[model samples]
Target chain A: LAKTTQPISMDSYEGQEVNITCSHNNIATNDYITWYQQFPSQGPRFIIQGYKTKVTNEVASLFIPADRKSSTLSLPRVSLSDTAVYYCLVDYNQGGKLIFGQGTELSVKP
Target chain B: EPEVTQTPSHQVTQMGQEVILRCVPISNHLYFYWYRQILGQKVEFLVSFYNNEISEKSEIFDDQFSVERPDGSNFTLKIRSTKLEDSAMYFCASSDEGSRNDEQFFGPGTRLTVL
Candidate 1:
């Protein structure tokens, strides 16, 4: 597992795009970057994951540089319901502990 | 899409009492995990189980905490003696194919209150 660094909080308005970046300079070759979203009183849900380059889903998009030192999650057209904590995790799989750090709390204003 | 499920949604127990938390991972998932979040704290991993045995565990999973896959579908975490510190929201998660690239689905979680 590689430790990740991200902002503590972010603010966005409805219909605006929000991008949260995570820094993991020490990410390993086998490590994969994953993003999860957690709402109040609810368990975390997977948002997007990537090994490198870019991957897009209906919910969000993930972009990783060629160096793989960092990654960003892009949420298009944010809504008030998007207010939640977002976690970025680097995992090697292989059964390592899935520890979560203090996530970035994104608050969407109306 | 299948999702993980936990039993008793909420359980309140007294100090030194034993409590068992149950989970049912997705049918096709090969790896199961347990994580707990103390109020106002980050989520912490407790243990991960695969092939009916524990593959890895965190230091927080001390002698007092135990996990079992007693049946095909039921996975459980037992606290030998509950303490005030045991009060937290425990979540069960599962992943298919058992790899870092695999997506892990989480259950709603069980809020345990230890008095």
Candidate 2:
């Protein structure tokens, strides 16, 4: 598993775009970049994932540079409901277990 | 719209007692997993199950921990003896395939308190 580093917390107001970056310098070729959002007392929910370049979804977007050393999760026009902890995970394609790190806690204020 | 469901929103047990946590995964999911999070801590993976057998497990899943799929829809985790350190929120998740892109739906989690 590739170790990931992210900000401990971030503050964003409603209608603003929030971008949380994760650094994984030792990412392997087979590793995939995945993001999960977790609300208080709730299980982590899948957000967006990408290997390289950009991937967009209904909820968020993921941007991974060619280097694959880092990735960013972008939430557009955030709302207070989006306040949660976001986790960035780098793992092999063969899913086994999720090794979680201290994720980035996003605070969306109205 | 399918989601994982876990029973007994919260459980309180005494030290050295055994406890079983039950989960009903999404009807079509084939892979199951168990994870725990202590208060103010990161979520930790305990084990993963597939095809009626364990695929992998973390060091945290010691001899005291076991997983079983007694029937078709239910997956269970058993702790032979409870310890104070075992107090945490246990989450059950399932995915259609054990692949990186396959999304895993997680349950509401069962809060286990060891007294």
Candidate 3:
């Protein structure tokens, strides 16, 4: 498991694109970067995951550079419902435990 | 989309009382996990189960805490003696392949209020 660092909070307006970045400087070769979104009083929902390069899904997109030390989660055309906490986790699936940090609180205003 | 399900969306228990949180993972999933989130705190892993046994547990899972797969369809987490600090939201999740890139689907969670 690698410790991750992310902004404590971010503010955006509806229809704006939001990008949250996470830094995992000690990421291992086998580590995978995964992003999750958590609404209030709900469990975290998986958004996107990637080992390297870029990966896109219906909800979000993940971008990883060649170094793999950091990654960004991009949510296009955000809405008020998109306001939630975004967490970045680094794990290799060996222990199968998810270690969550404080995460970045994304506030989308209408 | 088959999703994990948990019973008793909310539970109120007195300190020192025993409580069991029940969960039904996805029908075809193999790996199960339990996690907790205190008010305004990060989600913390409690334990992971596979092959009818516990594969890993965090320091928070002590002798008072236990997990069981009583049958094919149900998984459970039992706390022999609850404490005030045990008040939190517990989430159940399951992964199908349990590989490096496997996705774990999470349930709505049970909010346990220990008083």
Candidate 4:
């Protein structure tokens, strides 16, 4: 499994765009970039995932450069409800184990 | 949207006692998984079960831990003997089988407290 690195915390105001970047220098070809959002006392929810380039969904967008060494999760027009711990996971297809890091806590203030 | 449901929501047990956590995954899902998170810690995978057998398991899933799909609608995790270190929030998740994008849906989790 490839290890991932992300910010421990980030602060964003409502209606602003927040981007959290993750670095996985040793990412393998079969590895996929996935992001999950976890609220207090709730299970982590899938936000977005992408293999390469850009992928957008109703909740968020994922941007992966051609090198695939790193990727960013972008949340547009954030709301206070979006405040939660965001986890960036790599190699979702390997071993069925989703190793979670400390995760980036995004505080969206009103 | 469909959801994964777990029963009891919380459980309190004494050390060396047995405990069973129950989960009802989404009706169509074929892959099931167990994960846990200690207070203020990252979520850790315990095991994954598919097609009536275990596909993979982590080191944390020792001999004391066992899983069973006793029937069609229910999956269960049984801890033979509880320890203080076993206190954590246990989450059950499921996903559709064979899909390229198998996004696992999680339950509300059962908070296990071993006294």
Output the number of the DockQ-best candidate.
3
B1-115 per-residue lDDT for model 3 (tens digits): 7889998899999999999999999999999999999999999999999999999899999999999999999999999999999999999999987676778889999999999
Q: What 10-residue stretch in candidate 3 chain B is worst by lDDT?
A: B96-105
Candidate 4: give the clashing pairs: none
lDDT of 2 by residue, B17-91 (tens): 999999999998899999999999999999999999999898999999999999999999999999999999999
CAPRI rating of model 4: medium
- Model 4 alpha-carbon drift over 4 Å, by segment: B98-101
Q: List candidate 2 stretches off by more than 4 Å.
A: none
Question: lDDT, candidate 1, residue B6?
Answer: 96
Give the docking tier of candidate 3: medium
lDDT minimum window of 10 residues, candidate 1 chain A:
A91-100
Q: Could you give the fnat of all candidates in order?
A: 0.68, 0.70, 0.66, 0.48
Superior candidate under TM-score, 1 versus 2: 2
Order the candidate numbers by TM-score, best to worst.
Answer: 3, 2, 4, 1
Whole-model Cα lDDT per candidate?
A: 0.91, 0.93, 0.93, 0.91
Q: lDDT score, residue B31, model 3?
A: 94
Error of 1 at B95 (Å): 1.3
Residues A61-108, model 1: lDDT tens digits: 999999999999999999999999999999564555576889999999
Error of 4 at B62 (Å): 0.3
Candidate 2, residue A85: lDDT: 97
Error of 1 at B65 (Å): 0.7
Kindly list the per-residue Cα lDDT of model 4 for residues B1-115, writing each as its tens digit: 8999998799999999999999999998899999999999999999999999998899999999999999998999999999999999999999886343567888999999999
